[model samples]
Target chain A: NAGVTQTPKFRILKIGQSMTLQCAQDMNHNYMYWYRQDPGMGLKLIYYSVGAGITDKGEVPNGYNVSRSTTEDFPLRLELAAPSQTSVYFCASGLRGGGDEQFFGPGTRLTVL
Target chain B: QQQVKQSPQSLIVQKGGIPIINCAYENTAFDYFPWYQQFPGKGPALLIAIRPDVSEKKEGRFTISFNKSAKQFSLHIMDSQPGDSATYFCAASPITGGGNKLTFGTGTQLKVEL
Candidate 1:
């Protein structure tokens, strides 16, 4: 079902630059999420969407934005990138409720210089 | 607030040995716990999960032991192999709302030597 897919497998951005990490799921999941993983650290949520038009901030949402215009797409935007933003980003999708298991994408390795 | 806490930042085990990774949480609202395993350069994948109603759940060579009173849970790998080496993360979610809003603990890197 192509569970979850993310674009730009790897990327490097200069300070002040901006980019969007794309995520899609064919499972028709109603919940989508964006998370960042630092070296030797657990993943921290950046943003999430309950549905196409409902988005909310998570643990670490600074310097990031998200849009869920369609059930299949949830993209994360990083504006004015900073070195501290250098980390691996993952996109996941799940069913409607909180007990559902999430399907994750391969991940995008982003470097902000 | 670091809702979930995991210990043994790293572990090394001989082939065929059993490796256990531990985690604890402070939130009583969390009723679902799941473990994810991630290899280098890859995203984390669900291994096994247990709810507070069950004390143990086993899948293949992986097992999850949950303790409701202690607010703790653990993952154990039986007859560990080199392929089992990876970073394991324990996550919890509240019983309400979007269940996928997981609170993850620091990962435990497991290495199984042949």
Candidate 2:
């Protein structure tokens, strides 16, 4: 299996611009999550989905949105990007629940100017 | 507040030496603790994990030592090598509910020198 894959390995956006970071998993995991890692900091969750059509806000979900229309895809949308949003974003998926080990994508390095 | 706290922001050790990274948590409800290793420009990967019920778990050269009473845990790399160098993160999750969302600690950058 390809496990989890993310697109646009690197991206740069202007302030107020928008873009979508795409994530997909071939493992048919029921749980998917979006997290951002800042320099010298731990990852902060942006959003997550327990299953398709069920999404929830995480600790830092202010400037982002997510949709999990299928078990294979969970995409994160950044609207009206700001410089504070500059960070490396990761997408992960797990078969069972939050207690399970997650498969992560390579990551998308995003820069907002 | 930061639910999880990791220490020694960075660490450097000679090759073949053992490196230990520590972490502590405030939430007693957190039952699952995991360690993740991330190479530059890559996402974190699970290295090893421990549950509060267990004192220690070992897998190959990696080990997780847990202290339930102290509410702390640590990762130890035995006979460390240059390839073992990376940013390590410690995370915790409640046994149930919250969709298993994890609270991550500030990472520890490990460097193994020749």
Candidate 3:
């Protein structure tokens, strides 16, 4: 049940440097997300959480910052690392949102330099 | 503003031909229409979904064709293989918000050439 679980996977920040992009989930979801894939686009929703401590703000939430304390964690904090903040970062979980069935992970390829 | 609008960003189709992508939305309170599939580096999987009270929805060859009063939604990849190429997204969710996020579009890069 490693449903959703993302970690370093890959990173390279530089511009203003600030990291932290960890997400976890073992089912028991309650909606958690953080997407960013900008090459041809699609997948935006920068932050979301709807359970442990409730976080919000989506649609490219500026620099980005999230925290779900724990319901299997939700972390994504990229202070000033701008290179347009690179791309490819996904961490999803679901059990009460969108159209349900959304369990992704296996991604985190930041490269802001 | 790009509130979900995707089109022929790219497409090739040949393997068995039949690849349509199209997506459109301006939030008519969207009705949960999804389609995601990415390859080359992974992440982005949920391959098919539709619910505008259902105009169409298949699973085998992956199909979803909703048009809830023309807010639009499309994705049909019948037979086309080559592992179905990659990149294909079109999302819209608004079942009353609060956790039903997801409003994407601006992706379509299929190339099932054989």
How many clashes in each structure? 1, 1, 1
The DockQ values of the predictions, listed in order, are 0.73, 0.77, 0.32
Off by over 4 Å in 1: none
Per-residue CA lDDT of model 2 for B30-113, tens digit only, reads: 999999999987889998888887899999999999999999999999999999999999999996885779999999999999
Give the least accurate 10-residue stretch of model 2 chain B, judged by summed lDDT: B94-103
Two-chain DockQ for model 1: 0.73
Residue runs of model 3 more than 4 Å from their true location after superposition: A1-6, A10-21, A24-31, A34-48, A55-90, A93-113, B1-16, B19-30, B45-64, B67-74, B77-84, B87-94, B101-111
Best by TM-score: 2
lDDT of 1 by residue, A1-113 (tens): 87899999999999999999999999988989999999767999999998989999999999999998999999999999999999999999888668778888999999988
Error of 1 at A48 (Å): 0.7
**Who is ahead in TM-score, 1 or 2?**
2
Give one digit per residue, the lDDT tens place, for model 2 in A1-113: 98899999999999999999999999988999999999778999889999999999999999899998999999999999999999999999988885799878999999999
User: Against the true structure, whose DockQ is highest?
Assistant: 2
- Cα-based lDDT at residue B24, candidate 1: 97
| Model 1 error, position B75 (Å) | 0.4
What is the alpha-carbon lDDT of model 3 when measured against the actual structure? 0.86
